[model samples]
Each structure stands twice: as C-alpha cells, then as structure tokens.
Target: MFIEERTADDLALIRLLDAAFAELVARYGLEGRSGVGPGAHYLVAVVDDETVGCVAVQTTDVAGTGEVKRMYVAPAARGQGIARALLKEIESRATDLGYDRLRLVTGHLQPAAIALYESAGYRRTEPYGTYADRPGTFCYAKSLAG
Candidate 1:
C-alpha cells in the first residue's frame, strides 16, 4: 500500500469522502458538516491501486497546529492497520510542515477510533471548534517534539 497527495478536484476521492462521512453520520448521528471550503489537502491510501483510505490535513490559527479532517478507511481495510498508517503519514506531513500539535474531533460512539488515537499517544481534550456545539464530540490532541 502507498499514500499519495490528491488535488482538490479529485472526484473519486470526493466520493470516497462522501461515503465515509455518510457512514459517520449513520453510525453516530453526526451532523457531518464543515464550513471549511473544498481546498483542504487530502492524502489517499492505495492498496494494489485501489483507494482504501484517505485523510485530510488542514491549517488553523493555532500556531504549529494541524487539524485532522475526514479520515476514513474502507471497511475491508479497517483491521489491517490502514487507518493508523494513514494517520502516521499525516502526522509526518504535519511535522514537516512545522506543526508541533495535531488535533482531531471524533464522535464518542466510535470506540475503535478513540482507541486508535489513544494508542497513538493522543489524549482526550475539551471540545474544539464546531465540535464544541455538539454533544459527544471527543477531541484528541498530540503535541509534537519538533
């Protein structure tokens, strides 16, 4: 498997993101809406040429911080550590971009996701941004060394 950066107009990735986010809403009753426009940078995980997972890294006002947005791994690829790989890749990019902190907001109902972040050294934090307006939004943050 490999990861590649995707352009904003990549329709295939946009469809994948739509499906992934729809699942999030169906599973946790999430609103799944974002005011952040469509230019967010995306990374696609390909396994044998098939898009198995994807993640987006976006900028924020918080100095040295990178936001994890729209992370999703296809169901068949879930147990294979693809999500973790994608996250690690994103983190690496964040660090290279001079971000010292990485943060993400996920629904509490997604236990597996929470576990993934926790095992990756992320810690639970108070609600941030739009998540603060909704209940059960579990936010996690990890401060980088460099």
Candidate 2:
C-alpha cells in the first residue's frame, strides 16, 4: 500500500470517503455531515490502483495542535496494516508540518480502533475539541514531538 497527501477534495478520495461515510452513517447515524471541509490535508491509501483507505487532518482551535479526522479503511482492506500505516503517515505528516501534538476521537462503535490507538502509544485522554460533548466518544492523544 502507498500513502500520499492529497487535496481534501480529490475525486477518487471522495468516492472512497463516500463508501466509508455510507457505512458510518448506517452504523453511527452520522447523517448530513460533510467531511474534512477546507484546510484539512488528506492521506489516501492506494493499493493496486484502487483507493482503499483514507485519513484527514486539520488545525484545531488549540494552538500548535492538529486533529485527526475522517479516518477509514475499506472493509475488504482490513487486517492488512492499512489503518496502522495510515495512522503512522498522519502522525509523521503532522509532525513534519510542525504540529507538536495530535488528537483524535473515535466512537465506542469501533472497539478495534480503540485498541489500535492504544497499541500505537496513544493514551486515553479526556474529551477534546468538538467531540468533547459527544457521548459514546473515546478520545486519544499522542505527543508528536521528537
């Protein structure tokens, strides 16, 4: 798998995101929500010319901070380290962009993702950013400073 930064509005990435959003909507009821918005950079995972997974990041209200968003891997692409790779790429890119810290919030609907974050050295943190008031949300954070 290859990961590269793309505009948040890339067409192929949009298609993959639509697929993921549809699944998330059915599972999490996140309807009428648009993704990433402007100013967020996206990382797309391409495998054999197919866009299988993606993640996005943007500046948070917190100074020197960035927030992870729109992270998803196609169901058929699971178990192949795509999510982990995406996480690593996001972290690396965030660090390179001068962000000293990164944070993300994933819902309880994804236990595996929670475990993945924990395993990646992201510790459970209190509610943060816009997710602070959302119930069933689990927040995690990692210091990206080297």
Candidate 3:
C-alpha cells in the first residue's frame, strides 16, 4: 500500500470520512464529531490505486501538539496494516508540520482501534478538549520528539 497526503476536501478523503463517521455513529450513537477543523492535513492509503484508508491531523489548542482525526480503514481493507500505515504517515506529517506530539480519541467500544493505538506506542492520556467529560472515550497521545 502507498500513502500520500491529500487535501481535506478531496473526494476520496470525503468518502473515507463519511464511512468513518457512519461507523462512529453505529458504534456510539449520535455523538458529536470533534477535533476536525481548519488547518488539518489528511493522508490516504492506496491499494491497487484504490483509496482504502485515511487519516488527518489538526493543530490543537496546546502548542506543538496535533490531534489525530477521522482515522479509518475500509472494512475490506482491514487487517492489511492500512490503518497503521495511515497512522505512521500522519504522525510523520504532523512532525514535519512542527507538532511535537499527536493525540487522538477513540470510543471504548472500538477494541480493535484501542489495540492498534496501544500497539503503536500511544499511551493512554487524560481526555482533552470536548472529549474530557465524555464518558466511554479513550484518549491517547504519542510523542513525536526523539
């Protein structure tokens, strides 16, 4: 699989975002989708020229920090390491953009996602921003600094 940076408005990215949102709604009901805003950079994983996964990073209120957003790998693309590739690419992009740390929030219902984050070196961290008081939210952060 190959990963490349894409604009937030890219059609392929939009489709992946829609799918991710649908999955989130299915798993957690009608909760708000937060942390996606202006100045975000997105990346997509392509397999056989098909966009099969996507992830994004946006500047956070904290200096030198970015928040991971809309990370998703199509169901058919799961188990192929697309999510992990998208994540590693996004984290690299975040660091290149001057972010010293990356943070993300995933619902407790997503055990596979939780495992992915933990296995990727992300440590459980206190919920921040809008997610702080939202129960069932699992927050994680990984330092990009060596």
Distance (Å) between predicted and true CA of 138, model 1?
A: 0.4
| Clash count per candidate | 0, 0, 0
* Weakest 10 consecutive residues of candidate 1 by summed lDDT: 30-39
The CA lDDT of each predicted structure is 0.84, 0.85, 0.90
Order of models, best TM-score first: 3, 2, 1
Worst 10 residues of 3 by lDDT: 27-36
What C-alpha lDDT does candidate 1 achieve relative to the native structure? Answer: 0.84
Per-residue lDDT for 1-146 in model 2, tens only?
Answer: 79998886689888888887787788679642445757888999999988899998888878888988888898998999999999999999998788999888787888988988899999889997566787888888889877
User: Which model scores highest in TM-score?
Assistant: 3
TM-score of each model, paired residue for residue: 0.92, 0.92, 0.96
Record all residue pairs in model 3 with backbone atoms less than 3 Å apart, i.e. clashing: none
Report the lDDT tens digits of candidate 1 across residue range 89-130. Answer: 999888888889999887877889899999999998888777
